[model samples]
Target: MHQTETSDDQNSRQAAKPPLRIIISRGSDASSFTVRPLMAALAAGTCMLVIGGYLAAAGYMMLREDNSDTSRLTQAAQTRFYEERIAKLRARVDEVTSRSLVAEQRYEKQIAALKKRQGEINARHSRVADVLARAAESGLTIAASDPLPVAKPRPALAFDATLAESTEATGGAMVPIDASVDMLGLRGSMGGVAKKADRRTPASPEKATISSEPTGASAGLRADSVIMSRIDSALDVMNRQSETALDLIAVAAERRIARIERVTSSLGLNLNVDGDGVGGPFVPLTSVSFDARLARAEKAVAKLSSLRDGVKSLPFGSPLEGAHDYSSTYGPRLDPFLRSPAMHTGLDFRAPIGTPVHATAAGTVVSAGRKGGYGLMVEIDHGDGVSTRFGHLSRIVATVGDRVDIGEVVGLVGNTGRSTGAHLHYETRLPSGTVDPELFLNAGEKLSGIL
Candidate 1:
């Protein structure tokens, strides 16, 4: 067994140990070298491949992670910014809406006030129309020629007046009158605006120009001032018109007073003054004046009275109307008993024997007795030397010294004085002598005395 194993083992071992190092030697100045280029090249190439693979993997991983994080951060920032913007927008929108609502409310209030003013203006127009209608009926014409331009309307205004009313008493009743006035003005600027707009020209793009006016704010301000001024002028004119109307009313009242005074005078309800150029039918001629010499005394008596207030001290109404028929006249005439010319000096009225005899003025009775020719005669003495004589009376109702007013019953007509027929004989006399009586017997005027 030892002999067979020794050759195989010795050959295998020799083959495995065959490779060895080679060296080259030269002269003493030469060098010895060993070379393995292929082995060195393979080792270097292997190391470079390993490093390149590692670097490519690391760069790919870093790029992918960075892209993902950048996308997430961008999305978060966009959401936050959008939320803040939305909140700001909502606040601005709410503020604008509130302002709009307030402006609308103010506009509505102004419109309502304007409407109320218009209604008042319409009412005033109606009143003026009524006044004009009345004036037309009374043959009057109203002419308003001057036309002032309208500016703007003014706020409402008011005033007061005074008037008089007639009551049951003779005096007039004065009363306070309340009135109101409205004002407005005329203007022409708004009407001119239409003309200005019509004259505007079209814009041109080639022109390098900016519009001088930015907005209508200035125009609106100008219009307001003009309107206010116009309104003020109109108010002044309206005030003047009101004053003039009041003056006209005063003049009309004066005319009415004059007419009333004339009526009272015709009715003989006034007192009289003699020789002072003032008298009423209530005063007898003898009492009023005596040859026009006692004017000062008459004036002094008139000063003591207030006849201007329409008060009278005597009843001066007419006793008879046109029914009175004169059977005889005043002044000298033929006496019926004597059948020849004689002084009659009296007026006569023919009537039945029982016909009433009326007193002509306010007076006191002085006598009721038979006279020379006037049987059953009555004499009355009015104040201031004025006396009345009644003859041809059958019976007397008033006693001596009894006061009687005009139109009062004095006696009954009869044929008692030198009788020719049933009649009444009335006469007036002064302290000096007899005077004509028929002048004061007018039915339209007051009688001078009572008989």
Candidate 2:
């Protein structure tokens, strides 16, 4: 027993000590559990770690929501900036397109044609422009934007229908037209641009913006491929419209001139279209082919001038100022005095006594006195072999050789000539002899509004 007392025995006694015991109590029951100090501390530390983790997660979620709002606001501002930039670019493109609109008349074409016919196009455009200028000078001002001048063209059909559709397709906000472009001046610059266009190869839309243009062109008026294509199309439409207008005007003028010629022939008169006074320096025609359209236009212009010069000289005025009612017509009629078939050489106008007679046209008084049958008469010789005679006058105021103008008072009405009562005998004497006075008066009525 004395030999069992060793150091190892004491260390094993400390290590074998039991854990603490605790008792749990409730209303009618109770329980007991044992726990070590290290285990209690470890359980408390686990609960704290879970609570701290949950709080950290909540703060992170709130921060994320705030960041999302800031992100949305930043994105919206950038979108608006881009939208404004896009609008400005569109405005600039439209403005560039308006440059060609300054030219008058109209035409249209496809983008495919842009690659071909550069030199020919330049010359053709000049001629097309002249069509408008000439038409305007002839009193048919063809507006650049106007459709075909024909009344039926407003509805559109076939070619016109295509133009109408294209017009609608190209419609956009148009710039106001105030200034005019000098087309002749633009030729050189346009040719250079055309060369540049030809030298370049086709590229994608994104890279097809104009690189450079002639300095003589409108300042800073450049465009992308889309805008350039549209401009080309508009110019073509204008040219076509001009040609259509020229055709209509030329045809109409020619027909009117033809009718005028027939009327003059019936009167036994010649109308010299190229007047007596015309002299100018002769310049040869341009290198461009003499356009048949231009030739037609020139002819039309000549005819218009003829109407102004020749027709104005014709006796297209009334002999009686306000009253031209005829009691007896020219040609064979029953004689009012003899009651026999007689050849009437003049028109007898119904009028009261002492009515003032006016000269039918501008002329010199050749005879202004009484004759055998015509008691108190007057005869005036209008130029170009045209003469007028007024008989059966009460009193004659114009003497022989008196230069008289149209509508000037020459005499008074009365029963002076081979007396049938108070009336006027008017005769229009042509080279073949006295023709119908009514014919000239009727023609005058027809042309009163026009010439």
Candidate 3:
């Protein structure tokens, strides 16, 4: 009974799923081939595996493409953020640049003003230097040192005492100053100071250009500050140099004028230039500027020059050449012809018969002819109400209306007229009357170097 049940179960199972079979036949050969169920199943399993693998590969590729797109979008957003940040920074930079430009402009203006002032100061100093050079050329020279003439000390005013103290601190004591000497070494010291100032001073505008550039705003500001400081120092130095040079010129001119006045006064000469040609209301100097002071100094020098010119034309030279012996002195003496005590109006210089008699000063011949007591006489009319006469001459070489200079031979000495010997009778006359010739000769001797 168990065997029949087993066989029946097997038969039923086979009927439910019969074996997969396929047959092929060749008619002529009568041969056949069949595919079994197991082979068919194996083939199906292999096909399913290939299809699943293909599907899995496709899905993975799609996921990878999506991730790539997300990455691209994220990169774009980050780039936009960076671009906005850059724009904001650029705006801030522009603002800072504008502020820096304003500051730089201010500094440039200051530099321009300083340069102008420096130029002006340099011009002033140059003018003062020119004046000093002119003064030296005109014989108004001041030595580095000279003998200071003793003088009564001037009573110092309150202001003068204070000034003296200040001056003493600089280099010298408060004593009388010498006109020809550069007292207190003020001139040399001021020149030294000026030289030092020039060395320390900044360059001119052409040499030193204003710049406000740097790696950053801070650096530019610092550079500007340094430039400003340098310019300030340059300005200070230029101003001081100009002032010192002006002062030196003024002081030197005034002192020279004072010396000239003293010499002329001592010689009893009133050669002061007359200002009657120009008339104006008297105005005292209270607020005199540098230019005014310089003008006054110039005027003083001009006065000195006028006095020198007058002195040169004075009758101060001898009428005879070289050394000469006086035959008779001027004033009351025995007359040459009468031999009686009489007033002699002129000096008699004893010389050889042909000795040359020269003109004492430059003048025009007024007369050259024989007179009652002064035969072969020559009279010269020097300007300024002065005249000279040469008497007892051998020959009158100078004609009337002839202009003669000092030391020019006007005649020869001889025993003519009322003279007892070969001699020249010389007389000097002023507007007042005939005066002694010795007065001018002595004055000339005293001022030999001055003229």
TM-score of each: 0.34, 0.46, 0.50
166-259: candidate 3 lDDT, tens digit per residue: 2211111012223332222222211221110000111111111111046776886888789789878877866655454445555555554455
Model 2, residue 248: distance off in Å is 3.2
Each prediction's whole-model lDDT (CA): 0.48, 0.60, 0.62
Model 1: per-residue lDDT, tens digit, 1-451? 9987999899888777634345566666555444355556676788888888788778878887898789878877887788888888888888867765765575466456555654654554454445444433332223354233243233232211121110000100111223221221211211211100010111111111111033464565466556655655664455344333323332332233334344445543334322145455664332432223123322332332233222222223233322444545553333344333345466555455666777766788898877766777888777656677778788988889898876678888766746555666777766675655544443113211111
Q: Which residue pairs show collisions in model 3?
A: none
TM-score, structure 3 vs. true? 0.50
Better of 1 and 2 by lDDT: 2
The candidate that achieves the highest lDDT relative to the unseen native structure: 3
> Residue 302: error of model 1 in Å?
8.9
Q: After superposition, how far is residue 150 of candidate 3 from its true place, in Å?
A: 20
Q: Which candidate number maximizes TM-score?
A: 3
- Model 3, residue 100: distance off in Å is 7.0
Clashing residue pairs found in predicted model 1: 149-186, 150-185, 150-186, 150-187, 151-185, 151-186, 151-187, 360-449, 361-449, 361-450
Q: Which scores greater on lDDT, model 2 or model 3?
A: 3
